[model samples]
Target: MKNIFFILLSLVFTSITYAHEGGHGTPTKNWSFVNNNETIKADFIMKVGDMVYLSNENNEVLTFNYSEFKEQDQNYISEKANFINNLNFTKESHRLKTFDYSILLLLTGILVFVFSLFSWKTKPKKYFVTYNLFSASLIMMGCANTKSSKVLKMAANDIPFLESVFGVFNKVNTRHDDQYFYVESDGIPEHEMMTGITNWQQQVPVDHDYSGNNAWAIPLQPELAENTLSTKENFMKGAIAIAVNGIPIFNPLNNRGEDANVIGELDKWGGHCGRADDYHYHLPPTHLQTKVGEDRPIAFALDGFAVYGETTEELDENLGRFTSDSTYQYHAVKKYPYLIAAMKGKVELNPRTQAPENEIMPQAKTRGVRPDLRPLRGAEIIDFENPEPHQYSLSYTVNSQIHKINYGWDTDGNYNFEFVNPDGTTEKSHYKRN
Candidate 1:
């Protein structure tokens, strides 16, 4: 019975020594008076200036002015705020966690005294006493100077790191203001386009001026959203991310609510021409991994989260994981919503637009000189050729017959088009650039 009792006591001590390692407990206190003679129970998260953030019993995060609380609670909040301000959290290395050494020493002395008394009373064997002391020593040493789970949030993204990712492609240029890092390029990739598209629309790829006041903007400091916005029915109107090669990546689904890549609408590089003749990816261009390396980010979502190529870590529903204690980022997968399943960071949606077709503001805009065209049924785009300088031809086959659209432009902004019929007949049209 004595041996059993000692074993149980050691087990309890083992738990006590490590209980404070992972995290500290939060107490629910009456932070503010919601009504007369009634109060709201919330755990104080932290205080940022005058704002005191709290989590209610329902786990809902709430905020309020410190003055709104009772006098005693207000005093506690001020003391907490002052302690938080004095702590050095400027860098991850500086954020430290500590356990009271005095408490540990007190516990150690108590354990030794108890062991001595137990040995004297029970008259245990020499081997048992030695084993008990050794076991206790191991536990004490393990808890000595242990690091806790408290961590600091990452600082704002560095501009140089952003520059290096976009710099590998000569066609893309980058600049930054206080809040946003902007990228500019003519919206056409150096690789092939329009080939391997079985469900081709008659629209051809056009080079857009994705420069000047219309460049893509990525926030310098990303803020986590209170609730993540899912992508299934939202964000269908604008680009969700911008590729390192200066191309925009849209949602995996087309505006018609269909998987564009699986429907044979996308080319070999996972890109297709939109109704406005604008070329963009309906999925992540994972092929760019060869150029940017698999470890580095190949793109940045409009929500300002980095999009990495391949990862072995299990990702969350947002198609992302915390790369560090506080830095979270998205990764490319081989399934639907491959890049970002949702906007993991806070972004301002254009208020005028409604859900499923709403878009993030401060994004680049696109324009087309021609009207929207219907999809050419039974058409398969097999080849895109630049027959000569500034002149190009795109060929497609419908029912085993081939047709081509021969188009080109001049320095004066004048455009010309010749549509060659499969029956050896031809029709021509001309329009000047607006």
Candidate 2:
């Protein structure tokens, strides 16, 4: 009897709360995804990290990954949410808008008082049936008053804070509105590369297209994930973060889940060229501490948290800790999980992907001019030189025998390659960028 009474009582409070929540009569718009053919109607509410909240005609809440929406809908959702969230109310005015619990007490007290009078004027047995109804309604009102408010407070001036972090670097460009900060670059660093790589994959660095729509994005007001997802056996396909010098940073573990740095696949500065000849780092670029400062962040994770070089304090299970300002940050350590153990902030996974091969959405893509290459056994990248702009040469050794590749590109996007074999045989090839 008590359980049944509570259920009825709770519905009354819920209905009342939703009726006054300001979205009651709002019209919903059709929303579709890049992958899904079906569309749903929902009213845009807000963007929290990588997720967006919406409401239906019934005012019931719904949420989806932000990247799941089509390009145009994404713009609308972000813009609409910005306009709504910006209309902040003063504390005094806000307090007035809050639901008044006194009315609930008064209404329920009247119902109970009226029933009490009827019980006293007549046989109490007849009124016993309604006692549960009145008592439960009063209890429900009390519980509703204690429920936590759903209003989420976003971190303000995040764009300015991030600008300060990347301010010292000249190779990267940044811009933002209200939701996200986008960074554009060529995906190559200005520092020395490939000289310290003991294990060679027969690949050399090249400029990759990472501008415009393919630019990297970081959430401005990052939110914590409901459940922390570990980095192990995940985020292997794309970069986990990007260094301040415009270089992408991949997981310390290679796609096969082995430590790429410990396995001798990375150079002294912790970077290497991929199979696509696109350069990125598999470990923390702590060497950048010389430029960005030891106490500062050398990179920013895709989840929007800063990746600091070294810290004296201990880290949590995720290799991060909440700062004195109450914000979270990850540290770069010398051991395993060099930068991040798990994402400290919320992020969206590619909708078409699963685990291991799955990567974060909104990241830039790499375009290669040549076919993907395989590892050359016993090969070591001994030297890399950019004799002039748009021209580069790489030297590697296999069994102490020197081999070289001289490559360059022209204004027409035509690439010319000359390969010199260890036996002094030379071959030439050409490709046109599409």
In terms of lDDT, the best-performing candidate is 1
Which stretches of candidate 2 lie above 4 Å from their native place?
A: 1-157
Give per-residue CA lDDT, model 1, range 1-434, as digits (tens).
56865764775576466544533345457754433466777787766435577777666667777677878888888887677555533323432323454346446746765776667656667645554555565455435434342233545777999999899999999999999999999788878788999987788877777988999998998877745666776888889899988899999988877888888999999999888778999878888888988888888988888888868886665778877646788998886767788788888999998888888887798887577788889999989998765677999999989999999777776668899999889998876657
Q: Please give, for residues 1-434, the per-residue lDDT of candidate 2 as tens digits.
A: 66766676676666467435464575559998999799988888776545677777876667788899999999998887677555532433443444456356546756775776678657575455556466556645554543433333434426666787677788788888677788888777888788877778777777877778888888777777644555775788898888877789998888898889888999878889998889999889888889878888888888888889878786665778877664678998887777788787878999887777678877789999889788888888888898997788889888899989999888777889999998889999998888
CA lDDT of 209 in candidate 1? 79
TM-score of candidate 1 versus the correct structure, residues matched by position: 0.65
Clashing pairs in 2: none
Supply the TM-score for candidate 2.
Answer: 0.67
